[model samples]
Target: MAESPKRDTRDTTPDPKGRTQDRLIEHSYDGIQEYDNPMPRWWLTTFALTIIFSVLYVLNIGPIGAGKGWIADYEADMKAFAAAHPAPSGNDVSEGALLALVGDQKALAAGKSTFDAYCASCHRQDGGGLIGPSLVDNYWLHGGKITDIYKTVVDGVLAKGMPPWGKSLKPEQLTAVVAYVVSMHGSNPPNPKAPQGELVTP
Candidate 1:
């Protein structure tokens, strides 16, 4: 008996689903085949829109004006804020201004708290000299004037082992702490360490 030849199974025209199965012959692996399918209309439209949006965004055109990027807007806002709230001035940190705060019990308390947190380790809790110089004594490593104290606290005497507090403390806090140190004068705490600098009246 004669055997019949097998017919080819590959489609040569568009399928019922509208896929051009004839021209879409992808490489076969094992016994499986693939079709070169077209993407959905909605997906293609979205992809094109995204590309357009990227170009527009980079160019800053149409609805997006030039120099209107997020970073530019942020910088503008920061500049305006800085202009509105300027940095503190010398008068703001003056001795008289700080002394006035001494009269405010609240300010003294705040200053004491700040000193304890930062200065107490070296100066001791009672303002008696330890690793750092005493605040209660008439003598000072630096000048004892209110302005001098303010500068010392802000600039710090690095050579003498004190770190500058200017960056760490706010303007008001610096003034308050200086005021508190001034208030401690003549307190004469126990175990008072020997004075190290010129005598200046409080």
Candidate 2:
């Protein structure tokens, strides 16, 4: 009989440097085996850095974060803007000045234009009142004085539904609209809403 071939046995186990040999996982599928290897240190480091960066970014913005949040920043910017461009003073105008505009046909025309665009929806085109109280009647909800009317337009009645027009309307527009409203007093329209509020004598 021929002599049996000598069996050569060199260590197949992986060395401490992990370069000696590849270690196969115990499980196999369809005679295929996978090497048990760890992820590269560079790839893991990059993933960890991304997670840290995201956490820092969140903590620096919005209302929840450590930084002066977006709400505070927005409020500061608004304050600066208001300081730079101050609103026209309502107290400066006398009742006489506003009354004078009532006789000005040119002013009345502009006022009417603005009223038709904005006020007409609530107080009808004829000022007979629809959703709002009648302007043609002597009934005064806030007050009937021209100055009172000006304050109403500027400050608005929040309890009701009217919005403050001071910030939205230009100074001239506010003056003109108030003048138009004043001019409509006592000129009765065809069909008016039932009188509401305290009746004031002119």
Report every candidate's CA lDDT.
0.81, 0.83
Model 2: worst 10 consecutive residues (lDDT sum): 2-11
Candidate 1 lDDT, tens digit per residue, 153-180?
Answer: 9888899889888767888788889989
Where model 1 places Cα greater than 4 Å from the true spot, the runs are 1-91
The best candidate in terms of TM-score: 2
Clashes of 1: 0
lDDT of 2 by residue, 72-182 (tens): 777899999888766657544579999999999998999999999988999899999999988998888988899999999988888889988876888889898999999
**Residue 55 Cα positional deviation in candidate 2, in Å, after optimal superposition:** 29
Q: Candidate 2: where are CA atoms >4 Å away?
A: 1-86, 90-92
TM-score of 1: 0.55
Q: Per-prediction count of colliding residue pairs? A: 0, 0
